[model samples]
Target: MNIDNRIKFRHLLCFLEIARQGSLARAAEALAISQPAVSKTLKELEEILATRLFERSKQGVTPTSAGLAFLRYAGPSVQALRAGVHSLRSGEHEAGVARLGVLSTVESSLLPDVVRRLHDQHAALVVSVVTGPSAYLLGQLRVGALDLVVGRMTDSPQIEGLTFEHLYSESMILVVRPGHALLQVDLRDRSRLGDYPVVLPLAGTTIRRYADSLFVQCGIALPQQRLETLSVALSRRYVQSSDAVWIAPQDAVRQDLARGELVELDIGLREPGGSVGICSNPTTPPSLATQWCCEALRTAAADYRAALYP
Candidate 1:
Protein backbone atom coordinates (compact mmCIF):
# COMPACT_ATOMS: atom_id res chain seq x y z
CA MET A 1 0.00 0.00 0.00
CA ASN A 2 1.28 3.42 -0.98
CA ILE A 3 1.40 6.11 1.72
CA ASP A 4 -1.25 8.83 1.71
CA ASN A 5 0.10 12.35 2.08
CA ARG A 6 -3.50 13.35 2.82
CA ILE A 7 -2.90 12.15 6.36
CA LYS A 8 -1.49 15.17 8.19
CA PHE A 9 0.63 15.30 11.38
CA ARG A 10 -2.52 16.33 13.28
CA HIS A 11 -4.03 12.96 12.35
CA LEU A 12 -1.14 11.09 13.92
CA LEU A 13 -1.20 13.42 16.92
CA CYS A 14 -4.90 12.84 17.49
CA PHE A 15 -4.58 9.08 17.04
CA LEU A 16 -1.68 8.82 19.51
CA GLU A 17 -3.41 11.00 22.11
CA ILE A 18 -6.58 8.89 21.86
CA ALA A 19 -4.47 5.78 22.39
CA ARG A 20 -2.83 7.36 25.43
CA GLN A 21 -5.86 8.97 27.08
CA GLY A 22 -8.18 6.09 26.06
CA SER A 23 -11.04 8.46 25.35
CA LEU A 24 -11.91 11.08 22.75
CA ALA A 25 -12.99 13.67 25.31
CA ARG A 26 -9.80 13.41 27.32
CA ALA A 27 -7.69 13.51 24.20
CA ALA A 28 -9.59 16.57 23.01
CA GLU A 29 -9.00 18.29 26.33
CA ALA A 30 -5.29 17.48 26.10
CA LEU A 31 -5.09 18.80 22.57
CA ALA A 32 -7.20 21.83 23.48
CA ILE A 33 -9.81 20.96 20.84
CA SER A 34 -13.45 19.95 20.70
CA GLN A 35 -14.56 16.34 21.07
CA PRO A 36 -16.20 16.31 17.64
CA ALA A 37 -13.00 17.58 16.05
CA VAL A 38 -11.01 14.77 17.63
CA SER A 39 -13.54 12.22 16.48
CA LYS A 40 -13.44 13.55 12.94
CA THR A 41 -9.65 13.51 12.88
CA LEU A 42 -9.57 9.90 14.08
CA LYS A 43 -12.13 8.93 11.45
CA GLU A 44 -10.07 10.64 8.79
CA LEU A 45 -6.93 8.78 9.84
CA GLU A 46 -8.79 5.45 9.88
CA GLU A 47 -10.12 6.17 6.39
CA ILE A 48 -6.62 6.87 5.16
CA LEU A 49 -5.22 3.71 6.67
CA ALA A 50 -8.38 1.69 5.84
CA THR A 51 -8.28 -0.02 9.24
CA ARG A 52 -10.05 0.52 12.57
CA LEU A 53 -7.74 1.89 15.26
CA PHE A 54 -9.84 1.82 18.43
CA GLU A 55 -12.78 -0.09 19.86
CA ARG A 56 -15.25 2.22 21.60
CA SER A 57 -17.56 1.27 24.43
CA LYS A 58 -19.07 2.58 27.65
CA GLN A 59 -15.73 2.15 29.38
CA GLY A 60 -14.07 4.51 26.87
CA VAL A 61 -11.85 3.12 24.14
CA THR A 62 -9.16 0.49 23.67
CA PRO A 63 -6.76 -0.03 20.82
CA THR A 64 -7.41 -3.02 18.61
CA SER A 65 -4.66 -5.31 17.32
CA ALA A 66 -3.94 -2.91 14.48
CA GLY A 67 -3.89 0.06 16.83
CA LEU A 68 -1.46 -1.63 19.17
CA ALA A 69 0.86 -2.46 16.30
CA PHE A 70 0.71 1.11 15.03
CA LEU A 71 1.22 2.45 18.56
CA ARG A 72 4.51 0.57 18.91
CA TYR A 73 5.82 2.64 16.01
CA ALA A 74 3.77 5.83 16.43
CA GLY A 75 4.70 6.54 20.05
CA PRO A 76 8.45 6.46 19.52
CA SER A 77 8.24 8.35 16.26
CA VAL A 78 6.18 11.12 17.87
CA GLN A 79 8.54 11.37 20.81
CA ALA A 80 11.58 11.56 18.58
CA LEU A 81 9.97 14.30 16.48
CA ARG A 82 9.15 16.25 19.62
CA ALA A 83 12.68 15.84 20.94
CA GLY A 84 14.07 17.12 17.67
CA VAL A 85 11.75 20.10 17.73
CA HIS A 86 12.74 20.82 21.34
CA SER A 87 16.41 20.67 20.43
CA LEU A 88 15.89 23.05 17.55
CA ARG A 89 13.89 25.47 19.69
CA SER A 90 16.42 25.49 22.50
CA GLY A 91 19.54 25.29 20.33
CA GLU A 92 20.96 22.67 22.69
CA HIS A 93 21.45 19.56 20.62
CA GLU A 94 24.68 18.60 22.36
CA ALA A 95 23.07 18.62 25.82
CA GLY A 96 20.17 16.45 24.50
CA VAL A 97 17.61 14.85 26.84
CA ALA A 98 17.32 11.79 29.08
CA ARG A 99 13.98 10.12 29.73
CA LEU A 100 14.22 8.23 33.04
CA GLY A 101 11.78 5.96 34.86
CA VAL A 102 12.07 5.90 38.66
CA LEU A 103 10.46 3.74 41.32
CA SER A 104 8.83 5.08 44.50
CA THR A 105 11.63 3.67 46.69
CA VAL A 106 14.35 5.82 45.11
CA GLU A 107 12.38 9.09 45.29
CA SER A 108 13.40 9.74 48.90
CA SER A 109 16.98 10.97 48.33
CA LEU A 110 18.81 9.12 45.60
CA LEU A 111 16.82 10.38 42.59
CA PRO A 112 16.77 14.00 43.68
CA ASP A 113 20.48 14.08 44.39
CA VAL A 114 21.23 12.38 41.10
CA VAL A 115 19.10 14.91 39.19
CA ARG A 116 20.83 17.79 40.95
CA ARG A 117 24.26 16.45 40.08
CA LEU A 118 23.25 15.86 36.47
CA HIS A 119 22.09 19.45 36.17
CA ASP A 120 25.18 20.79 37.91
CA GLN A 121 27.45 19.08 35.41
CA HIS A 122 25.35 19.54 32.26
CA ALA A 123 23.57 22.82 32.58
CA ALA A 124 21.67 22.55 29.32
CA LEU A 125 20.70 18.90 29.50
CA VAL A 126 17.01 18.13 29.94
CA VAL A 127 16.14 15.28 32.31
CA SER A 128 12.60 13.92 32.40
CA VAL A 129 11.65 11.58 35.27
CA VAL A 130 8.66 9.24 35.50
CA THR A 131 8.00 7.63 38.89
CA GLY A 132 5.89 4.50 39.25
CA PRO A 133 5.96 0.82 40.17
CA SER A 134 8.91 -1.30 38.98
CA ALA A 135 6.89 -3.39 36.53
CA TYR A 136 5.28 -0.38 34.88
CA LEU A 137 8.63 1.44 34.64
CA LEU A 138 10.30 -1.61 33.15
CA GLY A 139 7.60 -1.82 30.48
CA GLN A 140 8.13 1.81 29.54
CA LEU A 141 11.91 1.25 29.40
CA ARG A 142 11.44 -1.62 26.99
CA VAL A 143 9.08 0.34 24.74
CA GLY A 144 11.52 3.23 24.18
CA ALA A 145 9.28 5.52 26.23
CA LEU A 146 12.11 5.69 28.79
CA ASP A 147 15.85 5.58 28.35
CA LEU A 148 16.41 3.71 31.63
CA VAL A 149 14.67 2.65 34.82
CA VAL A 150 16.03 3.00 38.36
CA GLY A 151 14.44 0.72 40.92
CA ARG A 152 14.34 -2.81 42.40
CA MET A 153 15.40 -5.48 39.91
CA THR A 154 12.36 -7.57 39.10
CA ASP A 155 12.73 -11.38 38.79
CA SER A 156 9.71 -11.93 36.60
CA PRO A 157 9.82 -13.28 33.01
CA GLN A 158 9.36 -9.67 31.80
CA ILE A 159 12.98 -9.01 32.77
CA GLU A 160 14.25 -11.46 30.12
CA GLY A 161 14.95 -8.78 27.51
CA LEU A 162 16.53 -6.22 29.83
CA THR A 163 19.95 -5.74 31.41
CA PHE A 164 20.32 -4.63 35.00
CA GLU A 165 23.26 -2.84 36.67
CA HIS A 166 23.33 -3.09 40.44
CA LEU A 167 23.15 0.27 42.16
CA TYR A 168 22.38 -0.68 45.80
CA SER A 169 20.34 -2.96 48.02
CA GLU A 170 17.28 -1.96 50.10
CA SER A 171 15.23 -3.92 52.60
CA MET A 172 11.69 -3.61 53.90
CA ILE A 173 11.32 -1.99 57.32
CA LEU A 174 8.35 -1.98 59.66
CA VAL A 175 7.77 1.62 60.69
CA VAL A 176 5.38 3.45 63.02
CA ARG A 177 4.86 6.93 64.31
CA PRO A 178 6.83 8.01 67.37
CA GLY A 179 5.67 6.31 70.59
CA HIS A 180 3.03 4.09 68.97
CA ALA A 181 1.46 1.46 71.25
CA LEU A 182 3.15 -1.33 69.24
CA LEU A 183 6.51 0.01 70.44
CA GLN A 184 5.68 -1.22 73.93
CA VAL A 185 4.57 -4.67 72.75
CA ASP A 186 7.01 -7.55 72.88
CA LEU A 187 8.92 -8.06 69.63
CA ARG A 188 8.32 -11.82 69.63
CA ASP A 189 4.56 -11.42 69.99
CA ARG A 190 3.75 -11.05 66.29
CA SER A 191 0.01 -11.19 67.03
CA ARG A 192 0.25 -7.67 68.45
CA LEU A 193 0.87 -6.41 64.92
CA GLY A 194 -2.57 -7.60 63.90
CA ASP A 195 -4.21 -5.40 66.50
CA TYR A 196 -3.15 -2.25 64.69
CA PRO A 197 -4.05 -1.15 61.17
CA VAL A 198 -1.35 -2.07 58.65
CA VAL A 199 -0.23 -0.17 55.56
CA LEU A 200 1.54 -2.23 52.96
CA PRO A 201 2.39 -2.13 49.28
CA LEU A 202 -0.24 -3.54 46.98
CA ALA A 203 0.13 -7.23 46.16
CA GLY A 204 2.59 -8.20 43.34
CA THR A 205 5.12 -5.48 44.04
CA THR A 206 8.67 -6.51 44.89
CA ILE A 207 8.55 -4.89 48.33
CA ARG A 208 5.16 -6.40 49.18
CA ARG A 209 6.58 -9.91 48.74
CA TYR A 210 9.31 -9.23 51.30
CA ALA A 211 6.82 -7.72 53.72
CA ASP A 212 4.44 -10.69 53.43
CA SER A 213 7.35 -13.10 53.87
CA LEU A 214 8.45 -11.38 57.06
CA PHE A 215 5.06 -12.05 58.61
CA VAL A 216 5.11 -15.66 57.44
CA GLN A 217 8.58 -16.16 58.90
CA CYS A 218 7.23 -15.02 62.26
CA GLY A 219 4.33 -17.49 61.95
CA ILE A 220 1.81 -14.65 62.13
CA ALA A 221 -1.07 -13.97 59.74
CA LEU A 222 -1.31 -10.70 57.87
CA PRO A 223 -3.53 -8.11 59.49
CA GLN A 224 -7.22 -8.12 58.57
CA GLN A 225 -7.47 -4.35 58.68
CA ARG A 226 -5.18 -3.48 55.82
CA LEU A 227 -4.52 -0.64 53.40
CA GLU A 228 -2.65 -1.52 50.22
CA THR A 229 -0.85 1.19 48.28
CA LEU A 230 2.39 2.08 46.54
CA SER A 231 2.08 5.82 47.03
CA VAL A 232 4.60 7.07 49.56
CA ALA A 233 2.57 10.21 50.26
CA LEU A 234 -0.60 8.31 51.16
CA SER A 235 1.27 5.74 53.25
CA ARG A 236 3.25 8.36 55.20
CA ARG A 237 0.22 10.52 55.90
CA TYR A 238 -1.95 7.62 57.05
CA VAL A 239 0.76 6.09 59.25
CA GLN A 240 1.66 9.39 60.95
CA SER A 241 -1.88 10.54 61.74
CA SER A 242 -3.14 7.14 62.86
CA ASP A 243 -1.82 4.09 64.74
CA ALA A 244 -1.33 2.31 61.40
CA VAL A 245 1.95 0.46 60.97
CA TRP A 246 3.59 0.84 57.57
CA ILE A 247 5.82 -1.81 56.04
CA ALA A 248 8.00 -0.03 53.50
CA PRO A 249 11.45 0.14 52.00
CA GLN A 250 14.03 1.71 54.32
CA ASP A 251 15.16 4.09 51.64
CA ALA A 252 11.57 5.36 51.15
CA VAL A 253 11.42 6.51 54.75
CA ARG A 254 15.09 7.23 55.36
CA GLN A 255 14.47 10.93 56.03
CA ASP A 256 11.57 10.17 58.37
CA LEU A 257 13.77 7.84 60.41
CA ALA A 258 16.60 10.38 60.51
CA ARG A 259 14.29 13.20 61.64
CA GLY A 260 12.67 11.11 64.40
CA GLU A 261 9.29 11.15 62.68
CA LEU A 262 9.18 7.35 62.37
CA VAL A 263 10.86 4.43 64.09
CA GLU A 264 11.84 1.03 62.71
CA LEU A 265 10.62 -2.07 64.53
CA ASP A 266 13.02 -4.96 65.01
CA ILE A 267 11.38 -7.99 63.38
CA GLY A 268 14.63 -10.02 63.67
CA LEU A 269 14.51 -11.32 60.10
CA ARG A 270 17.87 -10.94 58.38
CA GLU A 271 16.42 -10.86 54.91
CA PRO A 272 18.97 -9.52 52.41
CA GLY A 273 16.18 -7.52 50.72
CA GLY A 274 15.97 -6.65 47.03
CA SER A 275 18.51 -5.23 44.67
CA VAL A 276 18.04 -1.60 43.57
CA GLY A 277 19.55 -1.03 40.14
CA ILE A 278 19.38 0.57 36.68
CA CYS A 279 17.50 -1.45 34.06
CA SER A 280 17.77 -0.84 30.35
CA ASN A 281 16.97 -2.63 27.12
CA PRO A 282 20.23 -4.26 26.07
CA THR A 283 19.62 -3.70 22.35
CA THR A 284 19.31 0.08 22.54
CA PRO A 285 22.56 2.02 22.80
CA PRO A 286 22.56 4.85 25.32
CA SER A 287 22.47 8.46 24.19
CA LEU A 288 25.10 10.91 25.47
CA ALA A 289 22.64 12.44 27.92
CA THR A 290 21.50 9.01 29.08
CA GLN A 291 25.11 7.95 29.58
CA TRP A 292 25.70 10.99 31.77
CA CYS A 293 22.54 10.33 33.76
CA CYS A 294 23.60 6.71 34.38
CA GLU A 295 27.02 7.80 35.57
CA ALA A 296 25.42 10.34 37.90
CA LEU A 297 23.13 7.68 39.36
CA ARG A 298 26.08 5.33 39.94
CA THR A 299 27.94 8.09 41.77
CA ALA A 300 24.91 8.87 43.91
CA ALA A 301 24.43 5.19 44.72
CA ALA A 302 28.07 4.84 45.70
CA ASP A 303 27.78 7.83 48.00
CA TYR A 304 24.67 6.35 49.60
CA ARG A 305 26.44 3.00 50.15
CA ALA A 306 29.50 4.72 51.66
CA ALA A 307 27.28 6.61 54.07
CA LEU A 308 25.73 3.32 55.20
CA TYR A 309 29.16 2.26 56.54
CA PRO A 310 30.48 5.59 57.85
Candidate 2:
Protein backbone atom coordinates (compact mmCIF):
# COMPACT_ATOMS: atom_id res chain seq x y z
CA MET A 1 0.00 0.00 0.00
CA ASN A 2 1.13 3.59 -0.63
CA ILE A 3 1.65 6.18 2.11
CA ASP A 4 -1.23 8.17 3.61
CA ASN A 5 -0.51 11.78 2.65
CA ARG A 6 -3.24 12.82 5.11
CA ILE A 7 -1.09 11.76 8.08
CA LYS A 8 0.98 14.81 9.00
CA PHE A 9 4.07 15.16 11.23
CA ARG A 10 1.79 16.32 14.10
CA HIS A 11 0.06 12.96 14.04
CA LEU A 12 3.37 11.14 14.32
CA LEU A 13 4.51 13.45 17.10
CA CYS A 14 1.27 13.00 19.07
CA PHE A 15 1.24 9.23 18.62
CA LEU A 16 4.86 8.86 19.72
CA GLU A 17 4.31 11.05 22.81
CA ILE A 18 1.11 9.23 23.84
CA ALA A 19 2.92 5.91 23.55
CA ARG A 20 5.86 7.29 25.51
CA GLN A 21 3.80 8.93 28.25
CA GLY A 22 0.86 6.46 28.17
CA SER A 23 -1.76 9.17 28.74
CA LEU A 24 -3.33 11.82 26.57
CA ALA A 25 -3.15 14.35 29.42
CA ARG A 26 0.56 13.67 29.94
CA ALA A 27 1.15 13.84 26.22
CA ALA A 28 -0.69 17.15 26.12
CA GLU A 29 1.47 18.47 28.91
CA ALA A 30 4.60 17.36 27.06
CA LEU A 31 3.44 18.98 23.79
CA ALA A 32 2.26 22.17 25.55
CA ILE A 33 -1.34 21.63 24.43
CA SER A 34 -4.64 20.81 26.07
CA GLN A 35 -5.75 17.25 26.78
CA PRO A 36 -8.66 17.69 24.34
CA ALA A 37 -6.23 18.64 21.56
CA VAL A 38 -4.16 15.53 22.25
CA SER A 39 -7.33 13.40 22.10
CA LYS A 40 -8.47 15.06 18.87
CA THR A 41 -5.03 14.60 17.26
CA LEU A 42 -4.93 10.94 18.32
CA LYS A 43 -8.44 10.38 17.00
CA GLU A 44 -7.37 11.88 13.70
CA LEU A 45 -4.34 9.59 13.55
CA GLU A 46 -6.45 6.47 14.31
CA GLU A 47 -8.88 7.54 11.59
CA ILE A 48 -6.08 8.10 9.08
CA LEU A 49 -4.66 4.64 9.76
CA ALA A 50 -8.15 3.13 9.82
CA THR A 51 -7.22 1.25 12.99
CA ARG A 52 -7.26 1.64 16.75
CA LEU A 53 -3.71 2.62 17.67
CA PHE A 54 -4.14 2.56 21.42
CA GLU A 55 -6.36 0.87 23.97
CA ARG A 56 -7.54 3.56 26.38
CA SER A 57 -8.63 3.12 29.98
CA LYS A 58 -8.78 5.02 33.30
CA GLN A 59 -5.35 3.57 34.15
CA GLY A 60 -3.87 5.13 31.01
CA VAL A 61 -3.28 3.96 27.41
CA THR A 62 -1.40 1.04 25.99
CA PRO A 63 -0.49 0.42 22.37
CA THR A 64 -2.77 -2.00 20.62
CA SER A 65 -1.28 -4.63 18.31
CA ALA A 66 -1.66 -2.26 15.39
CA GLY A 67 -0.05 0.52 17.43
CA LEU A 68 2.97 -1.61 18.27
CA ALA A 69 3.39 -2.56 14.60
CA PHE A 70 3.18 1.10 13.63
CA LEU A 71 5.67 2.09 16.33
CA ARG A 72 8.44 -0.07 14.84
CA TYR A 73 8.70 2.30 11.89
CA ALA A 74 7.35 5.51 13.41
CA GLY A 75 9.87 5.76 16.25
CA PRO A 76 12.88 5.48 14.00
CA SER A 77 11.29 7.72 11.36
CA VAL A 78 10.89 10.56 13.85
CA GLN A 79 14.38 10.07 15.26
CA ALA A 80 15.98 10.12 11.82
CA LEU A 81 14.03 13.17 10.74
CA ARG A 82 15.00 15.03 13.91
CA ALA A 83 18.68 14.18 13.39
CA GLY A 84 18.48 15.29 9.76
CA VAL A 85 16.83 18.55 10.76
CA HIS A 86 19.50 19.20 13.39
CA SER A 87 22.31 18.50 10.92
CA LEU A 88 20.73 20.72 8.23
CA ARG A 89 19.94 23.61 10.59
CA SER A 90 23.46 23.61 12.00
CA GLY A 91 25.01 24.09 8.58
CA GLU A 92 28.15 22.01 7.87
CA HIS A 93 29.71 22.66 11.27
CA GLU A 94 27.67 20.21 13.40
CA ALA A 95 27.82 16.45 12.87
CA GLY A 96 24.39 15.89 14.40
CA VAL A 97 23.91 14.06 17.74
CA ALA A 98 24.56 10.68 19.34
CA ARG A 99 22.44 9.92 22.37
CA LEU A 100 23.96 7.24 24.57
CA GLY A 101 22.68 5.15 27.51
CA VAL A 102 25.38 4.05 29.92
CA LEU A 103 25.44 1.52 32.72
CA SER A 104 27.84 1.50 35.67
CA THR A 105 29.74 -1.18 33.80
CA VAL A 106 31.56 1.42 31.71
CA GLU A 107 30.93 4.76 33.45
CA SER A 108 34.28 4.85 35.20
CA SER A 109 36.89 4.19 32.50
CA LEU A 110 35.76 2.93 29.10
CA LEU A 111 33.07 5.59 28.61
CA PRO A 112 35.50 8.45 29.27
CA ASP A 113 37.94 7.07 26.72
CA VAL A 114 35.23 6.69 24.06
CA VAL A 115 34.00 10.27 24.61
CA ARG A 116 37.51 11.71 24.42
CA ARG A 117 38.18 9.79 21.22
CA LEU A 118 34.81 10.82 19.78
CA HIS A 119 35.42 14.55 20.41
CA ASP A 120 39.04 14.31 19.28
CA GLN A 121 37.78 12.92 15.97
CA HIS A 122 34.44 14.74 15.56
CA ALA A 123 34.86 18.00 17.44
CA ALA A 124 31.44 19.42 16.65
CA LEU A 125 29.42 16.23 17.26
CA VAL A 126 26.68 16.62 19.85
CA VAL A 127 26.91 13.75 22.31
CA SER A 128 24.59 13.09 25.24
CA VAL A 129 24.96 10.29 27.76
CA VAL A 130 22.40 8.79 30.16
CA THR A 131 23.60 6.54 32.93
CA GLY A 132 21.40 3.79 34.37
CA PRO A 133 20.72 0.07 34.67
CA SER A 134 20.76 -2.43 31.79
CA ALA A 135 16.98 -2.86 31.75
CA TYR A 136 16.25 0.86 31.76
CA LEU A 137 18.97 1.75 29.26
CA LEU A 138 17.96 -1.08 26.93
CA GLY A 139 14.32 -0.02 27.13
CA GLN A 140 15.33 3.55 26.14
CA LEU A 141 17.52 2.22 23.33
CA ARG A 142 14.65 0.11 21.91
CA VAL A 143 12.69 3.31 21.67
CA GLY A 144 14.38 6.22 19.83
CA ALA A 145 15.48 7.85 23.09
CA LEU A 146 18.99 6.46 22.82
CA ASP A 147 21.21 5.81 19.83
CA LEU A 148 23.25 3.14 21.63
CA VAL A 149 24.07 1.63 25.04
CA VAL A 150 27.54 0.59 26.02
CA GLY A 151 28.27 -1.78 28.91
CA ARG A 152 27.93 -5.38 30.17
CA MET A 153 24.24 -5.69 29.35
CA THR A 154 24.56 -8.65 26.94
CA ASP A 155 22.75 -11.01 29.31
CA SER A 156 19.73 -8.75 29.87
CA PRO A 157 16.43 -9.86 28.39
CA GLN A 158 15.92 -6.29 27.13
CA ILE A 159 18.81 -6.88 24.69
CA GLU A 160 16.57 -9.12 22.55
CA GLY A 161 15.82 -6.92 19.53
CA LEU A 162 18.99 -4.85 19.69
CA THR A 163 22.45 -5.67 18.35
CA PHE A 164 25.41 -6.17 20.73
CA GLU A 165 29.09 -6.25 19.84
CA HIS A 166 31.49 -7.76 22.36
CA LEU A 167 34.28 -5.33 23.11
CA TYR A 168 36.08 -7.47 25.69
CA SER A 169 35.48 -9.23 28.97
CA GLU A 170 36.05 -7.48 32.33
CA SER A 171 36.46 -9.43 35.52
CA MET A 172 35.15 -8.66 38.98
CA ILE A 173 37.70 -8.35 41.75
CA LEU A 174 37.63 -7.91 45.49
CA VAL A 175 39.22 -4.63 46.51
CA VAL A 176 40.33 -3.05 49.77
CA ARG A 177 42.01 0.11 50.98
CA PRO A 178 45.80 0.36 50.78
CA GLY A 179 46.47 -1.06 54.23
CA HIS A 180 43.42 -3.28 54.78
CA ALA A 181 43.99 -6.45 56.82
CA LEU A 182 42.89 -8.71 53.96
CA LEU A 183 46.08 -7.90 52.11
CA GLN A 184 48.14 -9.78 54.70
CA VAL A 185 46.19 -13.03 54.31
CA ASP A 186 46.46 -15.69 51.61
CA LEU A 187 43.57 -16.32 49.19
CA ARG A 188 42.59 -19.49 51.10
CA ASP A 189 42.69 -17.73 54.43
CA ARG A 190 40.65 -14.85 53.09
CA SER A 191 37.43 -16.87 52.97
CA ARG A 192 36.46 -15.52 56.39
CA LEU A 193 35.25 -12.35 54.61
CA GLY A 194 32.09 -12.28 56.68
CA ASP A 195 34.11 -10.68 59.48
CA TYR A 196 34.20 -7.27 57.84
CA PRO A 197 31.69 -4.84 56.32
CA VAL A 198 31.19 -5.18 52.58
CA VAL A 199 30.10 -2.95 49.72
CA LEU A 200 27.89 -4.44 47.03
CA PRO A 201 26.02 -3.38 43.92
CA LEU A 202 22.33 -2.83 44.54
CA ALA A 203 20.07 -5.81 44.04
CA GLY A 204 18.53 -6.25 40.55
CA THR A 205 21.53 -4.69 38.83
CA THR A 206 23.47 -6.87 36.37
CA ILE A 207 26.72 -6.56 38.31
CA ARG A 208 25.12 -7.47 41.64
CA ARG A 209 24.61 -11.02 40.43
CA TYR A 210 28.34 -11.24 39.82
CA ALA A 211 29.06 -9.75 43.24
CA ASP A 212 26.81 -12.32 44.90
CA SER A 213 28.35 -15.16 42.94
CA LEU A 214 31.80 -14.17 44.09
CA PHE A 215 30.63 -14.91 47.63
CA VAL A 216 29.12 -18.24 46.56
CA GLN A 217 32.41 -19.20 44.90
CA CYS A 218 34.27 -18.54 48.12
CA GLY A 219 31.63 -20.30 50.28
CA ILE A 220 30.98 -17.08 52.13
CA ALA A 221 27.91 -15.12 52.99
CA LEU A 222 27.65 -11.35 52.83
CA PRO A 223 28.42 -9.83 56.21
CA GLN A 224 25.66 -8.39 58.39
CA GLN A 225 27.10 -4.93 57.76
CA ARG A 226 26.79 -4.61 53.98
CA LEU A 227 26.21 -1.50 51.92
CA GLU A 228 24.45 -1.91 48.58
CA THR A 229 24.50 0.82 45.97
CA LEU A 230 24.58 1.56 42.24
CA SER A 231 27.12 4.35 42.53
CA VAL A 232 30.69 3.23 41.85
CA ALA A 233 32.05 6.40 43.41
CA LEU A 234 30.13 5.75 46.60
CA SER A 235 31.25 2.16 46.83
CA ARG A 236 34.88 3.14 46.16
CA ARG A 237 34.89 5.91 48.74
CA TYR A 238 33.24 3.80 51.44
CA VAL A 239 35.65 0.95 50.87
CA GLN A 240 38.67 3.28 50.89
CA SER A 241 37.78 4.85 54.23
CA SER A 242 37.11 1.64 56.13
CA ASP A 243 37.72 -2.11 56.20
CA ALA A 244 34.73 -2.89 53.99
CA VAL A 245 35.43 -5.27 51.14
CA TRP A 246 34.20 -4.23 47.69
CA ILE A 247 33.24 -6.31 44.69
CA ALA A 248 34.16 -4.10 41.78
CA PRO A 249 34.36 -4.51 38.04
CA GLN A 250 38.06 -4.42 37.15
CA ASP A 251 37.69 -1.47 34.84
CA ALA A 252 35.94 0.62 37.51
CA VAL A 253 38.97 0.54 39.74
CA ARG A 254 41.76 -0.05 37.22
CA GLN A 255 43.51 3.26 37.80
CA ASP A 256 43.28 2.93 41.58
CA LEU A 257 44.82 -0.53 41.40
CA ALA A 258 47.61 0.84 39.17
CA ARG A 259 48.19 3.75 41.53
CA GLY A 260 48.33 1.48 44.63
CA GLU A 261 45.36 3.24 46.19
CA LEU A 262 43.32 0.04 46.12
CA VAL A 263 44.38 -3.61 46.15
CA GLU A 264 42.78 -6.49 44.24
CA LEU A 265 42.24 -9.81 46.01
CA ASP A 266 42.17 -13.13 44.19
CA ILE A 267 39.01 -15.14 44.79
CA GLY A 268 40.59 -18.04 42.87
CA LEU A 269 38.13 -17.98 40.01
CA ARG A 270 39.53 -19.21 36.70
CA GLU A 271 37.31 -16.87 34.69
CA PRO A 272 36.24 -13.67 36.39
CA GLY A 273 34.35 -11.47 34.00
CA GLY A 274 31.38 -10.95 31.72
CA SER A 275 30.88 -9.53 28.20
CA VAL A 276 31.56 -5.78 27.94
CA GLY A 277 30.25 -4.21 24.71
CA ILE A 278 27.99 -1.91 22.74
CA CYS A 279 24.31 -2.40 21.87
CA SER A 280 22.19 -0.49 19.35
CA ASN A 281 18.72 -0.78 17.86
CA PRO A 282 19.02 -2.38 14.43
CA THR A 283 15.83 -0.73 13.16
CA THR A 284 17.19 2.80 13.31
CA PRO A 285 19.66 4.08 10.74
CA PRO A 286 22.57 5.62 12.64
CA SER A 287 23.28 9.31 12.04
CA LEU A 288 26.77 10.70 11.27
CA ALA A 289 27.51 11.39 14.93
CA THR A 290 26.28 7.95 15.98
CA GLN A 291 28.42 6.35 13.27
CA TRP A 292 31.42 8.32 14.47
CA CYS A 293 30.61 7.30 18.03
CA CYS A 294 30.36 3.64 17.06
CA GLU A 295 33.68 3.86 15.24
CA ALA A 296 35.24 5.46 18.29
CA LEU A 297 33.70 2.80 20.53
CA ARG A 298 35.15 0.02 18.41
CA THR A 299 38.56 1.68 18.46
CA ALA A 300 38.28 2.18 22.21
CA ALA A 301 37.17 -1.42 22.71
CA ALA A 302 40.16 -2.71 20.79
CA ASP A 303 42.49 -0.68 22.95
CA TYR A 304 40.53 -1.62 26.09
CA ARG A 305 40.81 -5.34 25.38
CA ALA A 306 44.55 -5.09 24.86
CA ALA A 307 44.99 -3.08 28.03
CA LEU A 308 42.81 -5.37 30.15
CA TYR A 309 44.25 -8.63 28.87
CA PRO A 310 47.92 -7.73 28.27
| Model number with the top TM-score | 2
lDDT of each: 0.83, 0.84
Question: Per-residue lDDT of 1-310 in model 2, one digit per residue for the tens?
Answer: 9898999999999998888787899999999999999999999999999999999899999888898778777878888787766656747535557899988868888889988988787767778999888887876776588999999987687687689988888888889998888778776865678889988878887788888888888887788899998788898889989999988888899988999989887656723768888898889988777888889988988987787668
> Runs in model 2 with CA error above 4 Å?
18-28, 34-69, 90-93, 189-191
TM-score, predicted candidate 1 vs. hidden true structure: 0.77
Among all windows of 10 consecutive residues in model 1, the one with the lowest summed lDDT is 153-162
Task: For residues 1-310, write the lDDT of model 1, one tens digit per residue.
Answer: 7767897889888888787677999999999999999999999989888999999999899888788667666656666677668768755676678999888888777898999999889888888989877776766665567888888856644465578999888878899999998888777877787788899888888878888887787787888999999889899999999999898888889889999999988867644579999888765667789899899999999999998767
Enumerate residue pairs that collide in model 2: none
Best by lDDT: 2
User: Residue 196 lDDT in model 1?
Assistant: 84
After TM-score superposition, the amount by which residue 205's alpha carbon in candidate 1 deviates from its true location, in angstroms, is 4.8
